[model samples]
Target: MIRLVCSIVAIVLCVWKVFNWAWWKPRRLERYFRKQGIRGPPYRLIHGNVAENGAASLEAKAKPMNGFTHSIVPRVLPFLHQTVQKYGNLSIFWVGGNPRVDIMNPDLVRDVLLNKFGYFTKMKPNPVVKLFVTGLVSYNGGKWSKHRKIINPAFHHEKLKLMMPAFYTSCGELISRWNKLALEGSFELDIAPELQSLTEDVISRTLFGRNYQVGRQIFELQTEQQDLLFQSSQFAYIPGQETTATLLLWTIVLLSMHQEWQEHAREEVLRAFEKNQPDFDGLSHLKLMSMILYEVLRLYPPFPLLTRFTSKKAKLGEITFPQGVQVGLPILLIHHDRDLWGEDVGEFNPTRFSGGISKATKNKVSYFPFGWGPQICIGLQFALIEVKIALTMILQRFYFKLSPTYVHAPHAVLTLQPQHGAPIVFCKR
Candidate 1:
């Protein structure tokens, strides 16, 4: 009789747990956030807003934007854009059974990223994702700090200076290929794969200390890793190759569209190098190029969304975040926010960053292309130098414009990527 009673109690507990997870806990979180004036779309049972997100995204991606516009929050993250529009910055929305409160306000974003008290934590990555995206990104506690310490040396300024020759060689190879392709003065080519190859070679040389071409037997394994990294949409961070490649590709496309900025950047690059090979110190003189790159980063940020989850109940300013709820820092939305960036927010105006990021952001925690605070991407410095090398070399040798066949479909699969390839016509300088 006692065994029967215990078995019945166990069954009852299992049923209650399932019920709580599916229905009760979500509703409780919704009510909690709502009581504090954070309101979003009403949660609907188990699939809460997942279906809605999918349907909205499908509708948004059905066609390209009406024209060339950088206000891509509407295209890349249509569902979140709509939620923010209707529900305001601290809006609470549901992701399946999980409740996510998106922090669009810069102040809240700062607190979450700083994560001073360990209240907020990275959403544990899907196991498959952790295979390659391990190390600093995968860990949160002491392990994260330990890995960060270990990896810090690789991107130190001295290390990057040593890699300058590698940078020039990879870029020179690109110039040679484009020289052959544009023999007739102009060549229409999809520069995406070409740029990817350049960044890939740079990464190979940096990480493995040799050109990938020299050892096909080993580098073939690297190719397989590349395929896996891109194939997952739940990717928290884009690898070095994709991140830098996308930056260069978008810079080319944006510069092509806004030729005046292109002229300014080239003039600056020419003055910096002036027929001499680009060197480490010479990069500092390319101020206009820096402004253009920053502006491009603002417009087409590689990581569109910065997502985190609360590990425990915590207070931010006057508001409290409950445990089990996710916190989203929408970089795409915040970068393009009218309040933060002003009326001409959608336009490609590199001049906005003429006074550098501090002046452009007015010392706010608003501009973080590689994220901010402790967990910011470690490879940012390396990525910047790599991009500068490619841009400087390209500007010295060729002029490029968007190919007529190029489509302006910027969507986020893993990172924000061109749905169709970035086809640009390059003319010999």
Candidate 2:
């Protein structure tokens, strides 16, 4: 009788714990936010707002974007955009059992990133993401710092200068292929896959010490590796290539849309390379290209959403957040914020960055394409150098415009990508 009663008590306690975790705690947190005068879609059960969020995402993708407008917040992040539009900027929302407080104010974002309250910590990465993406991206605190220190020298500018030949070689192959397509006057081609292939090759050669030019024999051998992942350098390749490729693609499309800017960029590239093939010194001096790239990053940043978790009670601005709550910093929304970026926030104005990023942003923590604070992307310099080399080479040969088959839909699946492939007509210059 005693043993049976003890077993029943244990079972009862377990059930109560589950109930508290799945429902009660969430409601308590929800009420706390509500008391603070914050509003959002009400949390529902264990799923929270997941079902409604999914439905909104599907609805947004029901059709491609109608017009090629730079104001892409509605299309890319529909639910969050709608939430902000309805409940104001500083609002509350739920992600599963945790309350997510969406903070749009730049000062608040800077505070969260800088972890000013000493209560926030890095969000645990998704289990599926952990399977593939490794290294500095997945770490926080001391471990991330140690890993960053280990890889720091490889991405330094001087090291990248040594890799410029590899950059030029990979870009040369891409230019060669495109030159063939353009040889027969103007040609229509989907530039997305071509750019993806170019970035993959560039990463493979410079970082992996092997390229497709090395032939299929070694490729076959690599497929049989014992303990290693697909490639040791895949950590940098996946994230870096996706960002650089998308940046270059949009740079082409945006420039095609604005021909005068394209002319300006072409002139800059020509001046930089007037003596011979591009060198590190010459590439660094291409200020106009840098402005255009920064503008592209502003308009279509790769990592659209940055989320941080509170491990303990925290405060931002005037509001106090409870433990286990996630704070969202939607990069897209902040980048498009009219109050922070002035009236032309949605418009493509590279000249805003002509005075440099600090001046352009008024020295606020506003512009962070590669992120801010201690955890900024380590491969930022590598991505920049690779893309600049490729862009400089391309502008020297071809003038491109979006093909009629092209669609202007930009959506985020982890990173921002054109919904339809970037079909473009490349005319030989």
Give the per-residue lDDT digits (tens) of candidate 2, residues 1-429. 999999999999999998997899988887888888888988888888888888888898886776788999888888999999999988877788877889888888888888755676777878897665655666667766666777788988789899988898899998888888877888888888888888878877876677744522343355545323333355576777778888888888888878899899999998778525788988889999999999999999888888888888887778988778888888888888899899999899999999999998888888888888767888888888888888888888888887888889888876788888888888998
Candidate 1, residues 310-426: lDDT per residue as tens digits?
789899988998777788898999999999999999999988998989999998889888889988888888888889989988888888899999899999876789988899988
Instruction: Provide the TM-score for each candidate, comma-separated.
Output: 0.92, 0.92
Q: What is the lDDT of residue 372 in candidate 1?
A: 96
Clashing pairs in model 2? none
Backbone clashes in each candidate structure, one number apiece?
0, 0
Tell me how far candidate 2 lies from the true structure as C-alpha RMSD in angstroms: 2.8
